[model samples]
Target chain A: MFDQSNHLPALPGVGYKPQHYSDLLADPAPVGWLEIHAENYMGAGGRPIAQLKYLAERFPISVHGVGLSIGGECDLDPDHLARLEHLCDWLNPASFSEHLAWSTHESAFLNDLLPLPYTEATLNRVCAHIDQLQDVIGRRMLLENPSSYLAFDESTYEEPAFLAEVSKRTGCGLLLDVNNIFVSATNLNYDPRAYVDAFPLDKVGEIHLGGHDEDEDDHGAPLLIDSHGREVADPVWTLLDYTLARSGPLPTLIEWDTDVPEWPLLAAEARRAQTALAQLDSKVTA
Target chain B: MSQSAFNAALLNPTANRPNGLSDAGGRPAGKRFDVYRNNVTVSLREALETGFPATARLLGEQNFNTIATGYLRANPPSSPLMMLYGGGFPRYISAIPALAKLAYLRDVARLEYAMRQSYHAEDAPALDPARLASLPPEALNNARLTFAAATQLVLTPWPIHAIRAKALGESGENPPAHAQPTLVTRPEFDPILTPLPADQGDLCGALMAGKTLAEASTLHPAADLGQLLGTLLASQALTDIHVEERT
Candidate 1:
């Protein structure tokens, strides 16, 4: 495994937005770091890559990939893997991460993260893909747990157990999205705390916190959509506090991709996560 | 079900649920699967809308949604990059029989595609205007200018730039009756589209085909070469100028 000694700082960050590029360059503020979708910067060259070059000089950037489809049934796309390798080679980000969900199958790229059955077959497939990814990027990648509206009957293993097994086999780190735990637990009608307790916190290298919209499943159960369109909800914040209390501190990100708010608002959200991290530090030093 | 089969089911709403697919509670996952399906279609549709905003506006919300759905079902994204999505959209728009009345729609979509392409094109420093002016009079004939990667000349049979401006609320006047050839260039960050006269368009087309200034001028002898050069310089479209090597 590639050495991760210089991973992201255990502070609060936000997904980088183009509109806030000038503001960030002018005043980076107290923000700990910035994250970006890898695919967005995959173009040949332009303002997006140029802005990233500028920010990479100032902040520890995390390249969060949304398209790897690590959990796909088919072998990983060599072309996509090459592009990712090229990007990682150029950016040399502090951290690289992709979701545990699949977005591509049969060469058709589905835009959203889709869930998979957590079976032994899948565990093996995902581990192979993660191995390939780590080998190509020449660095360790954090596999983020996905928030889902449904679960499959073929899933022989629980989500947390499956993730633990994958980490054990691949030596990959985890990106524990507290909001995803809350959203998935709520949608699947389980206790969020239990899910968090069952997670392998020591294997976690980063954390994600995003806003979700509330709706109802067909059975009238509360369904939380992982829609990063607004501020982090109070429960998700509380969940973050819960997970941090166990994991100490991790590089947490405030992801607001859709209906993106002003830079100040997003910075404020990052500040809120920082407040929680500060509380953890206070408790630890106490 | 197999992973590919499951994905196929998710993409095609009309397809039957994959065998043995059930929710966490061991119940039928029909309603639950619908959520994933909705997420996929809705997100792709939103991406198409973002890529072709003017086309969406011209067709209106409901009509555009219908068209986007049909297009998506027919031509799902082959790449994960949203920027690379909707490449087949212009042709798809042109092939629609219902949109036959809007003859300029496809060209407008093509213009939008060009703007997107230019926005993401490779960055290069604009050549100084003096480089061209200081060229020895004899060398001027063989001087072949290299345009920036973001420079694109879009020739259309309709007033697409005007129509786009009106749709985007950038202009108050209605689109004119004449066909308009437009030049797209990204001097800084944002891509700008400028209307070009037919003669200038012909000259630009010729120049883009690797024709030297003298040879390109032959295509439009009456065109104001100075004005055309001025426009290109003003837009920072010319990246490098060099004398063509004698074979």
Candidate 2:
């Protein structure tokens, strides 16, 4: 099932920030790649574009989108799809992706990636949305797994099976965010490892490892919130190790959105992921 | 469902309470809708906090959160995602009847919002300083210079620049002596809010208004004309230059 056989690179990469542009450019560290939110650079001209240009010249770029509302019942957002096309034209990122959730209904942008039931109606809508995105952008996208809080009674399909179906239908790749698996598994009361094992590994083009927060559900049961804020937790690291062992080293990203740590701290986290991959490599070769 | 009715249902789910479109499954639909609404409101509020941490700090987190929620409900996002959430926030605050007593609030909001705008503003190369140096004094005066896309000269009746600086941690700096002109430029990736002297401010306004250098200088003779032009050029604030032949 694996066509791409080369081992992925093992250099550290942090979320590219405009505030640290000068610092990043000044010190030419051996950073591998930089990831940016596609929605932030949707506008025609701006500092976001400027800084991204400067960094893209030297580093591999990834355009991670937080919009597009792929799972929504409504048609694809033409305006967003156009902006995404423009971004792809301007910045030829190594990869482009969005979450497997809905964010908008009608015209009002809800601003959160809300979950959708895995039914035939949703599957058709999501496939149509993905087709529209590909038709506009002229490139395949990686759909990331979402961290969902609530489960719908109408969802007949299991999470992994639904994700596999989306990939099979749309020809889009998967962005496996292990932290989301842990969070959603805990919230929905499922086995995280089962999810990691069931994932269509051949379809996974990238990996996301982030930190989650501990919270209490309505029943006062412990839940994990995929906050993307603090350092990656030990359980998440273990899941990542499991994924690497299965996927055999992918382009893993460390995402820290809220309360972004200092550059060095983020750099260190990226290094930790690199170390995990290296450890896996040694075991596989031995 | 009809387009308008579907839109109404999505935007205001309560509109369909009579037909049971509100609740999904057995649970109250309002609870689910409330969760979605709360997420939208909180996300936009977080964008505001991220964009204008100083404003959030100055207004206090609770107050900012309260204002942000109201703004979200009043003007739900038109875009599928954020990145332009608070475009109307400044104007909203200016007319929010309750905030009328705080006159400077609008200016602060405007200043911070503009900074965010400029921060995300497009990247452009600054004008070459040597080009300015090569132009003859007469040609330099008559040359029509265009500022960079990220430079915005905002003239307000409030000491907005000083207020922003203080909010951003320049606590000991002296406040502006009076209402002044503020220049928001992104020399680098982040927007830098700098207070412009009266003469230089006039020159910037003239340049922004598509006036020739000579015309701008005529409006403010005391302006250091050389350094003022250089300040913009060095920072890439000036992008293109054209000198018209005398008619």
Candidate 3:
């Protein structure tokens, strides 16, 4: 087996933003760690890289990559892997993760995290990709479950089962995104709680929660778009509570990527996540 | 269906859904598949609309969206780095029949892209202007200077700096119907632009191309090389200075 774990404290973290850099430095509480998209810092040199260097010294950084196309059928992009290696070499972040989704086809990279079918073929493909990523990064990398808008007929395993098999095969940790779980459950007609019950909680190294938008399919069924443009929905928070109670506590994160609000508001969300972990802590102690 | 087919459909909204896709009911994923399609276009369009703000402003938001959709479908990103997604957009739109009349618009887009490149360029310290002053005249004449990675020279036949300034809501003198030369430099982190007097660009361009000071000075006699060198040094654009044997 491999080291499929991370060192992030089991506390709430917020995604880093340039606007909030000063605030984070001024009041460094509640936010126990920070996560950044690996591609944004792939540039040779800039303020983005310089700031990450500074922040890494102060807080634990989890390099969450969004563009690796880990589930694509093609071989992993060697140049992209080298860039990821270069970033990890210098930053040496506390944790790193990527979504179990494909974003590229041939030469064109679709900028969205497109869903993948969990068949034996894809299972093998994803495991190989993670093995390559972990080997290059020289550490265990967590794989996040993507929020899907539709299911595939070819899929041989349910989402949780597929995630488990990948973790088992690749020795990669799971970044259980409760919001994605909730969204996928509602869209795919499954009980979110049942889905969580089936999840392998022991392998979870971190958790993610983000805002989503509600829409409808052509059939008028509820469809949720994982638009991290606003506050997390109430039901997702409840689902997070359910998850934390079972998994104990983990390095939970609040991801607000679009139309970001003020620092205080985002920090408040982190405080709420902290309360969730704290509640679980009290139960264990009592 | 193949990932290529799915991606093709994602980029083209009118394309039919790939096989094997379905909603929870196991039926045809008509609108469900549309979600992925919508995400692909909307995200790429937003990246362009935000990236070339001046170009977006020249063409109003509504028009920009329409052009962005066209450009994205035609020149979908080859790489996953969205920061580098629009590298070819300036040329892509310059050939558009609708935008053919805005000849300077192409240069404006080029300037915007240069600014972005300079923003992410490697950081290097600037050589002090006094270093050039301390060099003896012969040594100075033979000196070949290196520029900061953030330095860029955009030479155009239109008042690009003025056009960009006005488009960005900055009050500036009405752009003349003549050529303009611009210098781009990032002293700290943010990239800024300086308008150079016409023809002085040749001197700076030559020096930037690694020409010796005497050789660059010979390229443009009317232009004040001393003043231009002082400005480049003041902008902290020069990184290294090597005085080679006089040639």
Q: What is the TM-score of chain B alone in each candidate?
A: 0.95, 0.84, 0.95
Candidate number of the best TM-score: 3
Q: Rate the local accuracy (lDDT) of all candidates.
A: 0.88, 0.75, 0.89
**How does candidate 1 score on lDDT?**
0.88
TM-score of 3: 0.97
Question: Candidate 2: misplaced stretches above 4 Å?
Answer: A1-14, A18-32, A43-47, B1-38, B80-83, B125-143, B171-177, B188-207, B211-236, B243-247
Which candidate number maximizes lDDT? 3
Task: Locate the minimum summed-lDDT window of 10 residues in model 1 chain B.
Answer: B21-30
Residue-level lDDT of model 3, residues A28-61, one tens digit each, is 6899889999989988687988898888878888
Give one clash count per candidate, in the order shown: 0, 8, 0
TM-score, each model? 0.95, 0.82, 0.97
Which ten residues in a row are the worst by lDDT in model 3 chain A? A1-10
Give the Cα RMSD of candidate 3: 2.4
- What digit string (tens of lDDT, one per residue) describes model 1 on residues A1-286? 1222378999998899998887777776668788999999988788898888877877888999999899988889898999999988878889999999898878789888988889989999999999999999999999999997777766889999999999999999999999999898887878999999999999999999999998876676677889999999999999999999999999999999999988889888988999999999999999
With a 3 Å backbone cut-off (N, CA, C), the pairs that clash in candidate 1 are none
Model 2 residue-pair collision total: 8
